[model samples]
Target: MIQLHDKIFKPFISSGELDETVSNMVQEVTKDLAGEIPVFVAILNGSFMFASDFLKKYPSNCEISFLKLASYEGTSSTLKVKQLVGLNTSLKNRTVVVLEDIVDTGNTIVEIADLLANEGAKDIKIASLFYKPEVYSKDLTIDYIGMSIPNKFIVGYGLDYDELGRNLPEVYQFYKQTDK
Candidate 1:
């Protein structure tokens, strides 16, 4: 359990479950990019841990890069995406995969795809460790989805609350205590 500020969070996804899910995701990603070497552009701050573990499991010939984007203030999405850092490589005619920690409102994803497209990326795919279908409002197809979960607030394995809990090996969700 993790207590941050006034919130109490209990373990939701254990380390074993997370590893298994990531293992399966790696298989799917390899199969999808079998013929092409894709450049994995990891969204920084959140995807650092996921990207590290994913690349270790993925034994394919690919390139890795990092770019930082922000859309969240506290635990809620601000609905406006801003790029803190830019991609350095030329993605012209290259297959690009956007690796994200979570996909909620899909605002950040839209901006990522648009930027890649404008830079002449031949193909773009979205890969995320977690997704909330209920909250996703964008008309975009998430190519790789690790798990489908509710819109509950979560933290761990790179997901953080107020810049904390990212080092946790497992994912956790806020627990509400009602009067009994």
Candidate 2:
């Protein structure tokens, strides 16, 4: 177990597992977007590691950009999604794929999709490293999912607890027993 601020997290997903998942997702994405060069817009901070690994394994040529959004203040979501950094790239009439670290409430995904749609994107697809279907309430579809995890707080592999544990190679779930 590891401590981040006042919270403790235990190993959940290993580094190898994450890598394998990413590789599989890349294969699937490559097949679907075979002819067209899609623009990958990665959500910043949490998705930095996943985006890097994903882009590195992507076999075909693609354009990449980043947008930073925020909703979480600690272990819980603030229930408000704010776009901290806006997109500068022209998404007009382009096939755009959004890369996210995790999708639970799906508010951020909704916001991004709306923004892309307003920009007149030809098509929009959402890709996430981790997904919690139990808590996802958005009508939008997540096209690519690396892993479907339980509704639990996790850190590491770009996910964090109070801005810590992002450097950890493996994913860790919050340990309820350690809260005391």
TM-score for each of the candidates:
0.95, 0.97
Global lDDT of model 2: 0.94
lDDT per residue for candidate 2 within 105-171, as digits (tens), equals 9998999999999989999999999999999998999999999999999999999988999999999
Query: What tens-digit string does per-residue lDDT give for candidate 1 at 1-180?
Result: 668766789989999999999899999999989989899999989999899999999888999888899999987899899999999988999999998999999999999999999989999999999999999999999999999999999999999988989999999998964333
Clashes within 3 Å, all models in order: 0, 0
Candidate 2: segments with Cα more than 4 A from true spot = 177-180
Best by lDDT: 2
Candidate 1 — which pairs collide?
Answer: none
